[model samples]
Target: MFCQLNKTKKRWRSMFTVVLTCPKEQEKCKLPPEVCWHIGASISNGSWLSQFLSVFLTDLKIDQIVTFLPLPPRALPLQELVDELYNFRDCYFETHGVEEAGRKQSDVAKEIEKTLKKLEEKEDHFKHKAEFLLQKGRCLNVAPDFSAVAEECLSRAVKLEPGLVDGWNTLGEQYWKKGDLIGAKNCFTGALQQSKNKVSLRNLSMVLRQLPAADSAAHAKQVMESVDMARQAVQLDVTDGTSWYILGNANVSLFFSCGQNPQLSQQALSAYAQSEKVDRAASCYPELHFNRSTLFQYEEMFSSALGGYSRAAELDPGWEEPLEREKQLLEYLRKVTELLQNKGKVKARRLRTMLSNLSTSALGPCSSPEFRSPTGRVGSLEPRTLSSLTQGHNAGVAALGKVVFSLASEGRMAFTFGMVDSEETCIVVMVYNTADSWGVLIGDSVVIPEPQVKRNSITHKDESFDFRSIRVDSPLLLIVNGKKQNVQSQLAASVSYKPLSE
Candidate 1:
């Protein structure tokens, strides 16, 4: 005989109810009231169920019956479930390169939710619930549209386990993402109180740079401290590219705030170079490229600047700052090139008069008779034309020119102007750390001593410009209209804040 079974176990007392009629009495007969059988089991020849049914059927002198049903799922061990969840989380964190990590974060989040739910039901007995909570918080921290919940979870985790360093760091990062700098700073500080990890140190360094200070001195101190913290983090792990990148940023901050020192710029560049060498994955970071580009742009290394900006833009398409900077730089170059190209047509007569009127006697202390040329000639200390300036620093030489066009200041830290010598050779002059009130007009004479020349040939997108430029790190080195300039004031450093990642 064949029979069907009901799938619902809770609603039905037995697998199924069967009714049969006796052959002689013509009356209905019922089988056993209770029959227990698991789903997904087949009754076949030689099977246990088949054997049991065969014996029972033989007692009643009945034929054989066969059936198949679904099986119930077995309960998974709690430890095994936690282990699986941790493995998945580890895979997500260890996967380098966001693009290649094809795992869906939403699915991971769902799994985390499921585990959390299980842990919560056994909260009174679970010993490692706080750790899993931290994992869930971290997973939510990176997942999209989960910041609020991530913060809540992270807060709960830290509350449950005050000594959890990772929880504090992650909570700090969450606050950073929300633009709560003070909260972020506090969380990082809390993490440091528990441990001296590089992540917290580097993150604290970044946050310190953005924090406001009481005065210029305090600001300078804060920036220096930030640099020091970053250095410490780098020392902790020399191979950490993220730490190196933060060090570079801190140095850049020092460069701008502490008088636009070229040495500081060089230090920042060195840090960036070290970062790239030790960590190839650093190339995947957009902010590193962008900040490096900023330094290059400041130094008038146009080609390298353009390349960095381009790479940064490619790395993060959602970020518009790189694109804007690239456009502004190209436009600036185009304008500068046009101005230089038209110098002859627009101010030829005035430029000639100014050049003729230029005198070495007006250079005062700058016009030294003991000054020796690059060739070590004593008598050749006289002013040379812009065309005579070779690539790199023209040591022991002075150049006199008439300013023909003044480009607008960039970041209010550098003053750029175009100038032409007696030979009508035009070049760009960039003076750093100059006050906003200081102005170099169109017809003023500019005398530069030991001018540092940089040749730039940049071709970016649909724009191209070629020019030679001079970088003057200090205004005290410049003589305008035969009078030596003094450093009365300097533009304050303009620091930028952005979300950073490791």
Candidate 2:
């Protein structure tokens, strides 16, 4: 004798809403079986929500609503559901709002503050003391007083417990804050030796990131070993916050060394996300935001990149990288908009006016450095004249369908792929190895990425052309070992080119 379907129906009676099925709204519904019908809507991704609802609804005093159901539904008498729901709701709201606000930059300072308070509260606990000290030292630029206190605390902890792995890590962090790279590196090494903790491994990797090129090979070796050790740490404790942070950072370094593989960038993002979740209050938010910004930039989501960098800047205002990136994003966005505008388009016209104002604002007052001409001579060249000419040239290039692609083939540093066009000849400049390595590759038969996007014409305001150019698109592939030390060897591969029909 199987239980009847009526039991399942009764179980759902109180849980479901029947707004239209109520007696007051009966005339609005013409369908059969209307008495029990419900405009049943529960939240999507119902796995977490169902359990949450199960708990929350138990405490809800909808007695009349519950009375509509039969006795089989009486299994809703669990107290655990109520407690879990309260906690889950609190956490869900906080995290969701934080993510939606995209205010992850302030997370570092906030977390550091919380950690400091916790450390002070548990001053006698050696592990907590060391962690607090280390985190405080890392965040010293914001509050230098914390750094002094952190160092003193770690020094005392080390004296009390010579083999404490975290004490050594805290010591390393203090050295790092003071710009003593070598000392920091040695301290991290000592910490790693004392303890095989993921946090220590990550600290070691961070110290290695500061090493010079001559020392980078050794750093890379250590990083790989640390990664292997971190993998084990992750396996041992999946919820370890420090382990995931280390893994994310390790992958970032690997990507920077191996060249810009989007997949690797994404992997790094996922690891960072996991780390952020393992401990929402971790002090690595700035790094996470910066890395994620770089990923957005790679994906050509310039607006998102700008937002991420802006957040990173908020987290660590003195960090120049994100600031520079934010400036670049604004400039690129403006340039892209101008190149795409059609004549008499109201929005485009508005954007142009906005961009004009931005350019003017960027120049600032005459005495300010932002406005001061790069050229020292006052009468020799009008700065705005030069700027206007450069802007015009760039705008023309963009309008002519040339997309600037930042390329990073494996084992290669990032480089600009653009064309050098003068009156007589046009040549592709494969600036290999470094930013200044501009090798003129004279060619018309170059293999451009397929199915190029059409761009507007520079001559006629309303006219657009279906054409391909090098200055407008992002890179496509991540070919390993594509980085050659010298471009001279590939000189024979280029052929001379004449300007195409406009």
Candidate 3:
């Protein structure tokens, strides 16, 4: 049945998704129905194994992924997944009854290359050929890089048979690894068409959840539909907790990426709680605990959220989300204390309540920086005025001056951040460069995986534009979303630029 489908795929190639081949041992298949494996896929191209496999660094996660992809400058710690692949290698030798000591952990290329060499020889069975390709790709892809050869192998396997759900899913996983959410979505959709696989559904939902918001009514409708599809996946298969967990996460996306939907909060919490209360095996998923903790943090259930985040960190000791969130929360907590000291009991309490409720959380759209001057709290700059911006403020960091720069293919935006109570705020002068039509975007977080600690600058992008600027936690972002004129690369040089402050 699937063989005919393969022939059909060759005739009409409209979609980007791969068609999977039949399994080599199909009499009674033991392998997973969907073979989507994402060692580390971001939005660019899901074959992101190089980021996680080569030197065993793995700081990237689904949250940081965007339609535009950038290589991490530093190595992320990925020892756990690396160890599993090593075990797979050893088990392969053991099952074949070979007695040579296992391959050195550091030399990942030798074994994967050996398999790649074997794949060079023609095989009669397309199913087996695809399996061999997946295996080699698996071994070869522990990253600091990406592999086109592996992508081709998997692509060929799926072309040989569209029903090979595993092949399609794996191919999609490669795209997800590279942060190519659109590509990942297509692959998972293809897998779902062949068979109702929960993993593919969950994965598709995840990719959809991370997409940037669409302003047009049509695009907004699509986002809601994507969230609903994720819910459907959970409804279709109630046995596992993964889909439930994904469903919770998808709702969180709706809250963040999409505009407000009053019930989203309760729905997200319900889904997370459901993941925890599900069968013991379902409760075992790490994402469940981590996501639950994140939602709790959002809800201002600080103590409970801390415990959940701690558990998530424990579950995946190498993972950084829980740890990073912990830091952000601590910073937020410290600020709360400062508010109490500076504003006295009444004012501090209101700010505390605001933090707890988070009426406008971290996912707001790009708008002009609420320069203290905008609200009449402080006055705008004139030719010779130098007001005491941070002289008396000891509780928090002050938003100093902002700058905007434009590049031909990209734009740069930065906000100078400094201690609200420290002398640095009073000493440094902030500068701003006006663009034709760009605004400052506040409340977004960007975490680069390569160099976990990027002290100098940060970069992020969406479907339309690219952004690069300083490393402050929530620095003002430069935007170039809809300018019709040709952008000049030297626009930034003409305008003054500076790094984001700590």
Candidate 4:
């Protein structure tokens, strides 16, 4: 009985909705009132009354009978009434018990293999079954995973019917889903060439919109023209949200071609804003919200940007942007709190409260304050010495000493040198100052370019003792050979050379 009802249900769905009636009446069923009511009561589980008539034909309740009789075609035969009631009951059974039954039958692979075998036989009766397998493959490809079998199945369908838009759309959508933008573009382009339907146009437009600018401006221009054609196809059928979206994108391309001119950018923004106005919520398109979020970011509207990211995630929960943006904002908030706390303007108690609030709000509730002791720590300013200079040495000198400056990491060194006393002494001086050079490491090397000279300031005096070191007014990089060295100690230490060139 259940199987018969299932077959009937499928048949009913395949044809237009129908009513059972007697051929002699040409309109109403030939069944008697009592019999009809009996039929209704059997199907009474539905809104009909066949079973009541079956049990109580002698009862003269004409008004009641009429009330139960649905207008003519709605009136049912006893047998047909029983069948529908059973079918409705089967629906309830499936709803409540199917999941448990399905859980027990864990050999999904076997079932799928059976279906695939049936599909390979090219049986027309199982076309829908074949299509279902193809659809399952398409779902797996939502991440754009290409399986040789899945592509084969979809292509087979396309071969069977060149005009089946679903096959092309599915193949193209698979490429689009997998982030193969070029593959998606090619497939969609092919789909468009094969069919000019609204669905195909919409898919092609979406792929085109995401494409980066082509290297050849001519190709880019051609692509831009295609965007317009896609937009027009959609506008012809505006009920779908995607058509308007394509139009918005075409306008954006036009705006982009206008370059950085403020007017053109505003126009692009306006176009995108129009796209945003369309009810994208009706369709699960995360790109809609993602694009809006980008525009908000450009405008420096943080809250709006976050809101866009959040909405995109809500539409497609797997999206990572909203979660990432929230994390970045929290990190930024922590930095801001640290900057405020370091100012030290508040009373100690107030400062502690503020810090606590910052920790709670920025780092979340589980955070604890970590304080460092000033006694044992030195930060980037202690002084140390390098080797001392010799009066008659040919090479440059190095000096080491203890910290002198407030921010000194090492000791300071100062030396005064001038020409040795002689009646006809000619003073020739050259000093190479080293600063800002970073040290090298294995597998990594640093390069320091010679500094450019901006100006030369030379001074001369009669007395040798009164003469000072020639100060080169320029930035100098201190390097240990080819690589730079870090001066962790901030002290005033300099090396001066008196030329032995003479």
Model 4 agreement with the true structure over 337-428: per-residue lDDT tens digits: 33323321334454344333221112111122231112222222111111112223212221111111111012111110111111111121
Candidate 3: segments with Cα more than 4 A from true spot: 1-128, 134-147, 212-219, 257-262, 279-286, 341-502
Cα lDDT tens digits for candidate 2, 1-502: 0111111344354443332234554455444432332112222224443454455455553334421111121111112322333233223334544443333334434644654554445446534454444433333323322266667766766766678776687677677777776877787778767866765666665655555555545756755664565566577678866677667766665655554455766777788789778876443355566666665555444456667777766655556777776766555444334332331122434434433332222211322333212223222111222112231123211111121222333322224333211111121222222434332221211222111222322211233222222221222211112221233222111111111100
Runs with alpha carbons beyond 4 Å of true place in candidate 4: 1-124, 128-149, 177-183, 209-230, 246-284, 329-502
TM-score of each model, paired residue for residue: 0.71, 0.46, 0.43, 0.40
The reply for model 1, stretches above 4 Å from the true place, is: 1-128, 143-146, 260-263, 368-381, 409-413, 461-463, 492-494, 499-502
Give Cα-based local distance difference scores for all models: 0.73, 0.44, 0.43, 0.39
Best by TM-score: 1
Candidate 4 has what TM-score? Answer: 0.40
Error of 2 at 257 (Å): 0.9
User: How many clashes show up per model?
Assistant: 5, 8, 45, 41
The superposed Cα distance between candidate 4 and the true structure at residue 153, in angstroms, equals 2.2
Q: Could you give candidate 3's per-residue lDDT for residues 1-502 as a string of tens digits?
A: 1111112345544332221223343333332333212211332243333322222212222232122112343222223333455455433433332122222333345655544444444334433655555555554554324557656766887876778887787777777666676887898899989998776877766665455555545545655776777778788877656677667777765664443343886898887777657744345444566666655544445566656766655544555766666555554444433332343223434434433432212212212244232123432222111133223221212232211111211222222211111111111111123343433322212211111111111111211111111222111222222111133311221211011000
Winner by lDDT between candidate 2 and candidate 1: 1
lDDT of 2 at 169: 71
How does model 3 fare in lDDT?
Answer: 0.43
